[model samples]
Target: MPLYKTITPNSQTTVKIWKITESYQDLMAKVNLKPVALERVLGMKSELHQRGFLSVRHLLQEFGYTDSDLFYDENGKPHLKDGKHISITHSFNFSAVIVSDLIVGIDIEKQRDKIAVIANKFIDYEFDYLNKMEGDYVKKLTVIWCVKESLYKLFATPGLSFKQHCLVIPFTLLDAETVAWIDYEDKKHRYNIHFFEFEGFTCAYALV
Candidate 1:
């Protein structure tokens, strides 16, 4: 499949998503990968994961970049050669990348009832606005989880606890946007959060 969606959140930021319907061999033949990336993809045991990786490279190609333009730091966070901030995520059948002049992070998660089981592990302040009795409880929980995960990716700090260090302001599904803060160490940071759901998956992105 080609590009699934594209969003220009700001003048200097672009988010692109790809729906992975191509076979591993097909995707491999289409995208140009660096030697390290080639070896990494071949080492993946699951074809689904390999396909997702390749789809991300395809998304990079859409932005006129190849695998050589990207690299990972010691913390496993990705970076671009040209110094723009980039965040990548893939879940099941979808892969996405967000590139921005400002610091940014993105996450995509499959909405499942099981998330409610582990909600307490990463949720705290946001529970005040969440009512489990509502029918959209699971969906709301998924959004909160993605929001925290997005903030985590942006911070990329060691020993940061999602439940303790991150706080997502109250938000409703209809609003589609909110604010979040990271109170880590002796400093505090803020972010603008945006989210949406499609095909049983929820995507949340934070711009700082």
Candidate 2:
């Protein structure tokens, strides 16, 4: 059980992160999945994705839930049977879950220079403050990506465009937290964003 870290952003919200260091077979043996989930995992072509899927079940156990207690909406957002808000993400060697009484979202992404190549796809106004020449440019981009990804998960709207609608307020790596907005359909909404890096990966969550 490589439960790497846990965070309580608020009294009602909890974040659990897992550092995936287990073999697919090892992780599979530790979690009991529903029939549909079992079939889904067996059908995955990538062993890494299978392990990531299993690790999330482990995180749900930490939250006192089981595979049967989770389900997905029409839009593919995860939900808890008990009506608590839930969001999940996995990347490379890391996976995370955020459960809260309030709506919330979480994402973990491996920081890679390649992300800069596609920055224009998901980035818009933030470019005004991002300096490609800066030494932490990749790190900053990763954070913005993670933040926007979290927002997307929470919003769970079909037409929400990250480039055109989501905006991450400027912040330095040291700040570790910032604000983000979803400007869609002529209405603006705000969220509190918290993020941090570990083992070459970044984890971020949004709360409203």
Each model's C-alpha lDDT? 0.93, 0.95
Please report how far candidate 1 places residue 132 from its true position, in Å.
0.7
- Candidate 2 lDDT, 1-208, residue by residue in tens: 5799999989999999998899998999988899999999999999999989999999999999999999999999999999999999999878999999999988999999999999999998999999999999999999999999999999999999999999999999999999999999999999999999999999889999
> What's the true lDDT of residue 164 in model 1?
97
Model 1 lDDT tens row, 62-174? 99889999999977899999999999999999999999999999999999999999999999988899999998999999988888888888888889999999999998899
Per-model TM-score versus the true fold: 0.98, 0.99
Q: Model 2: how large is the Cα RMSD against the reference?
A: 0.7
Highest lDDT against the true fold, candidate = 2
Clashes of 1: 0
Task: Candidate 1: give its CA RMSD in angstroms.
Answer: 0.7
Residue 44 alpha-carbon offset, candidate 2, angstroms: 0.0
